[model samples]
Target chain A: MSDVIKLAHGDGGKFTNELIKNLFYRHFRNRKLEEGIDAATFSVNEGRMAFTTDSFVVKPIFFYGGDIGKLAVCGSINDLAVSGAKPLYLSASFIIEEGFPIDKLEAIVRSMGDTCTRAGVNIITGDTKVVEKGSVDGIFINTSGVGIIESNYKMKTIESGDQIIVTGTIGEHGTAIAIQRYDIKVKGNFKSDCNPLNGITENIQDLYPYIKIMKDPTRGGLVTILNELAELAGLGVRLIEEKIPVSREVKAMNEMLGLDPLYMACEGRMVLVVNKLYAEKVLNRIRSLEGCKDANIIGNFDQEASLKVYIENYLGGKRILNTLEGAMLPRIC
Target chain B: MSDVIKLAHGDGGKFTNELIKNLFYRHFRNRKLEEGIDAATFSVNEGRMAFTTDSFVVKPIFFYGGDIGKLAVCGSINDLAVSGAKPLYLSASFIIEEGFPIDKLEAIVRSMGDTCTRAGVNIITGDTKVVEKGSVDGIFINTSGVGIIESNYKMKTIESGDQIIVTGTIGEHGTAIAIQRYDIKVKGNFKSDCNPLNGITENIQDLYPYIKIMKDPTRGGLVTILNELAELAGLGVRLIEEKIPVSREVKAMNEMLGLDPLYMACEGRMVLVVNKLYAEKVLNRIRSLEGCKDANIIGNFDQEASLKVYIENYLGGKRILNTLEGAMLPRIC
Candidate 1:
């Protein structure tokens, strides 16, 4: 059941079949994705479309709560989802190193298929290439997605006094990947926040039309996302540090590693900027989703000239959040 | 001017600037690309769209006639082109190794920008990430493109008696890459056939409204492509070996390496299956293009039961061209 992949795995033959079935299908089994075809097929209602592409090269294929395959699918789908579009199709391309395990590749592909099915998208077309052993790392996946948005459903821009809300906690994905990568042991259990955010976006979009910008706090985390929005909108943002909601485990780990949780990456969480009047309804709608039950308003936009991000401390002191100079955790995504 | 890449090349600052200016922009300079913005913005006629994504990790980044950057842009554009689409926008993502030369990365990006401009496409958005030295090779590029296809244009399937034509010679790309990779010495000069095929496709589409199928021979080469088409159409194909043109140098090199020229990859060339009546016109149109001046009719489809592909040799012998058993040249694309 576990053998290192030979070049035959990519040869489009029996070995490729075994790899797809045994490893990939094993972990990513789902009802709609059982059809083993070159591309998954589906239909969509008429609408204008939005599309996005993302590649996952996370060092360890399998990490805390998710693997590279799952991450690849979710990351791409979520990107399309937050752009106010209903993700419909995805194309996957793989670059596998020569000696990567066929079992591992299968697991990754199956997981990706299952993730797409859950997100209600089809894997329509794909390409696979193999490189010599030293040329590449284990495997790298590039996924491009297409989503349809009804012509009328344009999300507006963030304005002064708009509430900025986050779905659940932050820093979980970064911490999880970091810990698993370094094999660090902690007293409490830790898992990645690497779930899809489509459901929450769907819920909020259904209830209120006043929600402004929505973005996943990925690479530079909540702080960087806020900074980017501030600069784009020519505004400032203020948040209450105590109410920002970081788990004790993440905080402790950040302290241990001399890192800041605010700068960590979160795979599944998103920041929503909404009109102040609709913030309550949006929060309630988001709370009904499974992974976003802890949704909270983290900050508000301000019309300040400085264009800075400030967090009000528990002791009532304001601290500035600066953009990260370099990636805190290199290949976490 | 030629030096090994250093870490500062990917720092997103001063060194990155000089690298882009000297090596890449100097060679591929164009007005739109010179703006040096994160995304290139442009306009297109209104229509439904076809989109595609591709990543290039060809080893020795710099190949015979082209480098990874040009290949990445050309590959994505070609995918859109063959789909009967008018390519408009592209997004490039770069994953740079820690010590890659800033100059090289800049040169590559500029080359990519130039390629996009020549193909009448723009780089609309991009993401850049840097990994530790050992985590990645020199640099890997992922490009996603969106193209506008005329609503009236539909891709047609190949039918029996369709004449298959190949643009120019085959195996030039594979032989060139292989020669550089293995350090093979050949008496005659050789260069990779790595130009974009969108222009040639445009000319053909303009003349023939009924071109059945079009495909570029890349990773698995011409034989695999023919086999795929055969399987898709549930028919057999008969190719005349002498009529299938290849440069003498390439043929000599193939014999030297114990390789078959028919199984080698070609980037710029394409195999087109057209209704027999239009074959001559299509070949003439392709020949009118500078690089495809030698386009020739090489084979024809047949309604045989076996779905096999065969080549008639000069010695009056017929040889089966089977699906490639394994990758003949990894990363040839």
Candidate 2:
């Protein structure tokens, strides 16, 4: 009824009900959600399922490629996707500052609805709360999702010749956020790669037998995930520096900012470890998918070396890559 | 390693891993959680399941009876409990402000762990993010939970003469929050009724055949829920003013503050609609449980009256009760 949110909107009374019906219900309409009062009920077959959650507090709410609402949906979806499950349902919770514009809230909810529709996931249950102004910057969202695991998919142990493949060029999301956060002006077009990766996961569902592990290179980026995998598997990762794909725009921007693209974040990229025999096939399959033309087998695991990760230059020089040691960028995801 | 949270702790790298291992993993440890990398995966039988989520931003994070952490767990658990489901697993996500003391965070996490253990639910997966100081108040948590629906439970339609019952005294939680928030100095003891209601749900679970519906009188309180049920069921609620149970402390606090206990909140109470034939039995069962000694049959549905909710005084004077329309409390949870 008001132009902006009020304390009464979060009082769990008349205004809260009005907001849910006029805004959330209008956008996130689904059978399960319509019947839900306290909780959404649905039937699931007997199987293994994945559950995960993430809270989005990205500054500036709106960004080059997507807003916090889209990020919230994609972030949780990606988490379930990487865990070898097909995401099914999501629960969205919001904490908004009093006086936040109603139009902006509607826009964010619209984006979330659109994203979930594209990913074929339903937001089954949700909650909203309005804190006093200044208690929160503007708004924060938390999305928790559940997904059914593919019956054929199983995590395999890493072997001596396992190869690591990155689904796309790295660091687009981190660069986009940094540019906006630091008030840096950019010349050419640049945006975050903030799309859902469930499409890639679905396409590669048949290759689960060859996949040892899969992870989204999100907040910690490419190098960090490689370091984690190397340590987890107790093997060394030998990467070909030139083989890792990097977009020209992201590379130029990171160079100007004195940052490493390898350590920067990517919102919609996957790091997959596959047996050497099927690594090339997986890379080719990924490259055939949309937005994955740069997918490449950038490295391989070494059996003789200790747990470490390093990239070798074409000229024969090498540098060790550690788990991200500093706060290069905050809330990039 | 720092005394307070830093940007690096949320960077999803080494420090983040250390925080997860030393704190979250230590407190919320379980087989499913330990194996979780990006998401927690588990097996479930074929059946209907309930899913829900809530974000807790209750101010003064530490409260009279319980902390925000405990409230968050119980809030989500109660939602599922009232939905006729047995809660199974939960996901806890935190958005903390930078510079907040680590010890304070550990205390909150410990409270959450203890609450979940008592409720017989496991926190299988979680995520943590730290925002810059001043961006968020201090800390906010979102918990999403899933539960298995009991096969025999069915929501019977509310009919004429259906009885209304409340499982505890009303308004204790809202009164406690008001006192702490307004810095009221009172002589007698006062504490929030913030316990989980799963025990009560389990105790009366065998009477599913005669139960019409169940709802937690949380933020909007008893009067608001009655109004909603009357409108939804196309019947009138005839409440006997003297029959509604109220604690002496809450009654005195509301009277002093010029607030009506009927419209105040309760964190650990359930309002049940049951067939007249079984209402007395259900009330007796509820009264036998822990913390439910105040259970009472407060009213009954009127078939001849129009859809409305009203209270009848001892002199037979009637007053219409409406859904809560004003902002009486914020973040009462």
- Score residue A132 of candidate 2 by CA lDDT: 91
In model 2, the Cα lDDT at residue A110 comes to 98
Stretches of candidate 1 exceeding 4 Å from the true structure: A8-48, A151-158, A206-209, A303-305, B1-48, B151-160, B206-209, B303-305
lDDT of 1 by residue, A56-154 (tens): 878688987889988988887788777776676676777788788766776788788777767777766555666667767788888777676642345
Q: In candidate 2, what are the lDDT values of residues A203-231, reduced to their tens digit?
A: 99988899999999988788898888888
Score chain B of candidate 1 by TM-score: 0.88
Give lDDT per model, in order: 0.74, 0.90
- Once fitted onto the true fold, the runs of candidate 2 whose alpha carbons sit more than 4 angstroms away are none
- lDDT at residue A250 of model 1 (Cα atoms): 93
Candidate 2's displacement at residue B141, Å, is: 0.6
Candidate 2 has which clashing residue pairs, if any? none
For candidate 2, give the lDDT.
Answer: 0.90
* Location of the lowest summed lDDT over 10 successive residues in candidate 2 chain B: B150-159
True contacts kept of each: 0.12, 0.90
Instruction: Name the best candidate (by DockQ).
Output: 2
Candidate 2, residue A244: lDDT: 92
